[model samples]
Target: MARNQQNELQALQDTLYFIGGKWRIPIINSICNGNKRFREIERSIPGITTRMLSKELKEMEMSKLVKRTVYADTPVLIEYEPTEHCRSFGKIIQEMIKWGESHRAIVLKKRT
Candidate 1:
């Protein structure tokens, strides 16, 4: 591969390493949209088990995409929110949404 191609491939790989997964984007969307509590996130993303959500949240936190806050109280409150870096993904997510909608329409049209 040429030097430019190699650089582009490396960039893509690094991007995927941070946000590549079936659940990561959904989880980020939920948190970014103000679903802070753990239970709220689980509810927002149907079919995600507590164990899986917990693990994914930890991974996102480590990646600096999600911020985890804990409040020491009678009923300890823990919340998750997207970091500025993750918030910057809004445009990308919107583009993905538009593509997905168009793709779904095409797929449905073909099936009918």
Candidate 2:
């Protein structure tokens, strides 16, 4: 492949890897929508088990997509927030939502 094609391929691969999982994007959306606590995030995404949410959050933290914070008080509190890197992907997610809505309409129209 040409150098330009190789670069584009790598970029596409990276993006796919980032959003490859069933839970990653929804988890990111939950956090960006202000579901910071573990339980809150879990509840916000239906069909996500506690174990899956924990696993995804840990992976996202390792990938620098989220910042995990711990607070000490009467009870220890932990929260997850999207990092700037993750926030940058928000625009792409929004565009995807738009495209998905349009595609669904088209499919329904064709079916009718």
Clashes of each: 0, 0
Residue 70 local lDDT, model 2:
95
**What's the CA error at residue 12 for candidate 2, in Å?**
0.6
- Candidate number achieving the greatest TM-score relative to the actual structure: 2
Summarize candidate 2's per-residue lDDT along 32-112 as a digit string, tens digits.
Answer: 888899999999999999999989999999999999999986689998999988887866787888999999999999999
Q: lDDT per prediction?
A: 0.88, 0.90
Q: Which ten residues in a row have the lowest lDDT in candidate 2?
A: 87-96
What are the TM-scores, per candidate, against the unseen true structure? 0.88, 0.92
CA deviation > 4 Å runs, candidate 2: none
**Model 1 per-residue lDDT at 15:** 82
